[model samples]
Target chain A: MTNKRNQIKGFCRNVDEKKERLKKAFGYILKDKGFGNLGVNKVSLEAGISKNLIYRYFGDFKTLIEQYSEGIDYWTSQAEKRDYSEMTEKDVLKNLLGEQFNYLILNPEMRQLVLWGLHESNYNTTSLLKKRELFAERLILQKADKRFDGRIDYRGVVSVLMAAVYHLAAYSSVQKANFCGIDLSQDKGRKRVLDAINLILDNIYDLNEDKKKATNDNE
Target chain B: MTNKRNQIKGFCRNVDEKKERLKKAFGYILKDKGFGNLGVNKVSLEAGISKNLIYRYFGDFKTLIEQYSEGIDYWTSQAEKRDYSEMTEKDVLKNLLGEQFNYLILNPEMRQLVLWGLHESNYNTTSLLKKRELFAERLILQKADKRFDGRIDYRGVVSVLMAAVYHLAAYSSVQKANFCGIDLSQDKGRKRVLDAINLILDNIYDLNEDKKKATNDNE
Candidate 1:
């Protein structure tokens, strides 16, 4: 009985190791080639696992994509978890923008995946909406202030932030237009872009204050 | 001699009328199908002009798109030209946001054309770049306040505005998700979004003020 139990334990351990290896391989494949043009056979071969194993673990190609998308959300959420208490508001804003930039720039596969989500009809309803909501919620939470009154409109802020971040990301990934018609490669241009973002934030905040004051005076 | 001169004048008038008709037809076609999937032959037929005439006037499909783009830009610029002299800062911001929203929501064809410009590889580079630069310059000039002497970062402002506007445009166009999470259709949600944007803007302006003060102290 003891010998049989040891054999089963060894088999389970081996299976867990193989699962880890497969997930690592999947990341590499996704990073190297975008999800839009990824091949199941290639992913299976790269992972050094059977095609059967892929189906067994992730069901099918669509399911695999769904799983991959979930993983992306998980990873992004993890990366975005910051200690907001220690950081200034400006620092937080800068970090948020910079991190988003880095993710879109460095991860071509993920960029392509997002584009695919935007374009492909099959992936449109389930994965894209889920991801978008998750992204907005995560972002809103990260930037939320404890002092924020329930009266303060947060949807508008999310809308603006989403617009800013997604537009920049899309441009960087696909449009390749430098912000403010300035050369992105130069330090001056970079500073100008950063300054422009700061200005936009200032304008929105000022507008909010005016609204708030009006509300207060009315009350 | 009088009869011949009268005939020539009549011919010129007819030609001018035909040109006006074709231009109007072009606008209709653009509004209906968008530049991304335009059919030149169909446009020519619908315009009641010979196919060869389209080629003769616009040179090619690419030139046709460029012409349409320029026309749309001119129209938007004209529409957005406001007498800012008497407007408060909050009013100005509201006007800008409202104008953007209205423009995007109303002008579906122009919006699609802009999206195509971002995606299509065959767009004329020089013309597109020129248009973009001109648009950016106009926005900056219209919004800039020389007397403020604050570190109003125009580039950052542009970035944020463009991001917000474009993202909203894109998302609204493709929004298929039901109202489960992040319900953008709701009034309360919309208010929250506006408030969030205002808060971000306030922070940006505050930073600008600090920077201006620092610059003055240094001098």
Candidate 2:
């Protein structure tokens, strides 16, 4: 009876150890160099855990990716919670674009992981799209309809606004040198990107009003 | 003397044959299933050309890519020449977005090559920026300044507009899924994309007018 009890305690310890190791493995994947490119065995070795444990916990690499993807919505919501209620249209856009730019620049690993996810479309693109749709519905389209006095096509307006902001982030992240056109090692380039996004937002608001007038005339 | 003349003529014939074979090899590389995943042997075998001849003409696969990249400017110019001048701002934006959307859908192979170039930074993206700068200077910035009484930051405005358009093209090319929330394969989705661009443009124009008035009041 004592031997069986000891065996049960040992099994519980093994499960606890694996759970701790898996959490560390996730952090290692996010923080360490060459971790993204490592195979499952290499990641297991680096995490000081057995490959079988990883398989048992995460099921497979793809399942691990799905697990990670499950957290994207939470992160996106957190990012979107920056207050825009009291700001001008220009201010709102500037804040939005600025936030995205800063996040991508500060989080190179996450940015790279997002790029990998973007490239691998068969993964969790639906989750990404869901997050995007939420941003559109809650932040951009809703705000535009509320602020504007005309029959504005909110979806259309938001699409351009979102596309512009996303492009700025992408350019800064992937082709920073080409997009910035100045010294990339400094914050000057980043400022230029923000300025560019603000300008676009200003133009978009003006253009939307004009279209509303023309549509009314036609009616 | 007669034998020597025959030998010279035969040498010229062989050179011509090699050149023809190299051109055919380039086409095969561009059009074949294993494009982008190319090697010297595969290209040589597919083109029915000698490996030595492929090396002689192209130096390496990288050189071939460089040669192809050099031709992009010509193609872009040709694509840009499609008439939109007679259309309203909305129609112009619509046609532009439509053309970009269709290009991605219709030309998957070319899209793949371009995406690869974007990721690899293979071509001179600076040249692309220069072309964009020239387009903005001549078309949108100068024209808007001359025609409108609005406070417009020409460079910023143009940059945002171009970036938004580019975002649509880049997303469509890389993702192969419609972010416009409509089926890109259907006509309705195509119209929605065009309409969205138009709405964004109209709003921008209105916002510019507002900015101009605000500047006037400050003055």
Candidate 3:
């Protein structure tokens, strides 16, 4: 009985190790060659795992890709891990945007998915986008922040701000270019961008402090 | 001599037709299959033009793609055709952003390049992005209006607004998803976004009219 139990323990460890290796291989291939090269054969070759093992471990390439992709996407994985219990809804929204800016710049795999959404609208790209949209909806619209509605175009502002974050981070990461000569790729540009986001948010939310007071009084 | 002239004219007509055919094939392939399938062999096959002619007419694949891309990129082609001479610098900036928002939604080819910049940073994608950056830089920074400088973070603001436009346009064109429950792909959402952009600019520019007057008084 003891010998059988020890063998099972070793087998479970091996399975976990293989799964981790497969995921790493998936991300590496995504970063290296993008979706065009993300076939099961290519991934199996890259991972040094057999097709049978990939199917057995992760079911199929699509399942594996989605499962692995969920790990990299900010709204799906990283943002899900953050603790927003103590934060206000506005602060939470700001945190979401700030984290996405840094994540898109730093994470090439996520960046590739974001870029892939342009010309190629397939499961590989849309699924991640859907995940992001759904996640943000849950956080921003569903659970909290009904106070600011009709008072400001906060939704439009957030949409525009988030869009800019994705564009600047993804474009600048690859091309040493500028929008209006503001190269936000470098560190000096970081504070400027963050400050600008804060400034814009302040304009939309806090700048109308008296208006908010008037609304409160009327209510 | 008349017969000889007629033969030369027919030969030139065939050459022009063949070039146009090749360019059309290039765009179709880009739209249908994206860069992964956009090879000279494929384009030649699709166009039914010989490889030798593609070389003789357009030089090489890179040159052909670049030349073809220039025709489609807004800043390089369409925006270049616009008469912004009558407009003030701020108005010019507004027009630039507005045109881009509409164009990105309407033009899949340009949208593809904007989206492609996220993951695939190659000649096909980067060339278009470089063209846009240079055009905006020249228009926004070089030729006019340093009045807004030091008074505000217009560069940061523009960068953020432009970034959001890209993200919203490209993502919505595909996903039909909402950002903050605002389905900006619709016409009603268009006004909300445009108004938000105008409002942000007003907050940045006109809201500080008193401040500008104060600064002028100091001067």
DockQ winner: 3
Q: Model 3, range B1-219, lDDT digits (tens) per residue?
A: 999998999999998888889988998887777656678999899999889989999888888888888888878888878888888767887888787888878887777666656666677676777778787876775543376646767777777777777777776676655556777668788767777787787777764575679888999
Tens-place lDDT per residue, model 1, A56-149, is 7666766666656555642344444556557755455556666665566555555545544433336523465666566545544435433234
Q: In angstroms, how far off is B41's CA in candidate 1? A: 5.0
Give one digit per residue, the lDDT tens place, for model 2 in B1-219.
Answer: 999999999988987776566555654665444233556677678767778876677677656544544443323544457665776543544455556556655554444343333343434444454454455344445556654553544344444555565555545544645553444435565566567666555555666677778878999
lDDT: which is higher, 1 or 2? 1
Error of 2 at A9 (Å): 11
After TM-score superposition, the amount by which residue B118's alpha carbon in candidate 1 deviates from its true location, in angstroms, is 2.6
The DockQ-based order of candidates, best leading, equals 3, 2, 1
| lDDT value, residue B193 of candidate 3 | 78
Worst 10 residues of 2 chain B by lDDT: B114-123
How do all models score by TM-score? Answer: 0.63, 0.67, 0.91
What's the lDDT of the predicted structure labeled candidate 2?
0.55
Residue B44 of model 3, lDDT score: 95
In model 1, which regions exceed 4 Å deviation? A1-96, A106-126, A135-147, A172-181, A185-219, B1-35, B39-50, B74-77, B80-94, B120-129, B135-139, B142-152, B176-182, B186-219
Judged by lDDT relative to the true structure, which candidate is superior, 2 or 3? 3
Query: What would the per-residue lDDT of candidate 3 be over residues A1-219, giving only the tens digit for each residue?
Result: 999999999999999999889989999998988766678988899999998999999887778888888988888888888878898777887888788888888988888777666555677676777777787877776544476656677777777787777777777677665566776668778667877887788777754565689888999
